[model samples]
Target: MAMAQNFRSAFHGFNREDVVRYLEYLNSKHNSAINQLKSENQTLTDELKALRAQTVSNPAAEAECARLQEENQKLLQQCGDLAGQIAKLQAQMEEAQKNKPLAEEELEAYRRAEQAERAAKERARQIYCQATGALAEATTQVDEAAEDFKLLSQRIATQMTDLQSTIDRSKEALTGAAATLYGVCSADTDSQ
Candidate 1:
């Protein structure tokens, strides 16, 4: 999402609360995504264990489980990368705030920092969306695989029902976060 560059400039510099709040919001949103991914990973792991416990071994099901696990790992890695980027951005903001300079150079530096933060936020959002899509696809594949096994189908159907609810909640949370961000950005624009 494109945000205006205008920030409410204070006597000494741009409003610290505005910058801090924006960063905090991004951090919260990213953290939520990370937690959701972790929960899903755990669920998949549990399901894999259950599948293995069955006496009747299906090679195709095992292969599908392995693929899902690998995808979960990749998603986790992406989340870790995003988290690292957020921390770096937060550090840069804090450092900029501490070294507040009443000069044109300082204003330029602040602008650069803001731009970097925006880029990071955009990247995080993209990653979250991608991960969500991948998860839905994976779940569908799991459902399809479950159909081949009588016992597995019942278990997966129950799990999918629960997972659907979780996905719904995640989507709601994401929407709320986006709305909060828009409101914050709008307030900043109005303040200017």
Candidate 2:
């Protein structure tokens, strides 16, 4: 830009025509510089407004972000709770596995005891059957023996009666023989 010429005397320094021309030139340059600066300022102000609009948040977006953060925290807490529950269940399963052998042993012992009891009962039943059979056989034998004794007693009684009858007949025959001999002897003596 150019500066305007100033004079203190009428004839001591620059000419009037030269001063007037220099002042006009300076005024034009100044006006052109000011217009260019104003245009640049306006462009810069527009860019700044656009930048502020991009950076600023709407109310709905801000609320949505807050809600999403709260939900994320709740999900994280639930995950931790599920992990704890899984760990507890795993420990219980391990404890049950440890006791499995003992439980099986006890079950086996009970089965053996039940089988032994059943076997003993069967043996006792067999013995009882055998004893009943023996008793029946003994009773049959005793009955047969008693029948034989009765038959023998009857046969002995019949034989004794027959023997007594034969002895009485023999005695009567001997008495008749003795009477005949005595009559003969008495006749001979009388004749002599």
Judging by TM-score against the true structure, name the best candidate: 2
Which candidate leads in lDDT? Answer: 1
Relative to the true structure, candidate 2 reaches a TM of 0.46
Point out where model 2 deviates above 4 Å.
1-65, 155-192
| Cand. 1 TM to true fold | 0.45
- All models, RMSD in angstroms: 53.8, 41.9
lDDT scores for all predictions? 0.82, 0.65
lDDT of 2 by residue, 1-192 (tens): 224324333333444445445544544544555555455555555554554566567676556555555655565555556556555645655655576667667768988999999999999999999999999999999999999999998999898888778777777777777777777778888889
Model 1 spans with C-alpha error above 4 angstroms:
1-6, 10-13, 100-192
Candidate 2 at residue 137, lDDT?
100
Tens digits of per-residue lDDT for model 1 on 1-192? 122254577757667666666677677777888888888878888887887787887998889888887987897898788789788878977876776554557778889999999999999999999999999999999887777686777878999999999999999999999999999999999999
lDDT of 1 at 127: 100
Clashing pairs in 2: none
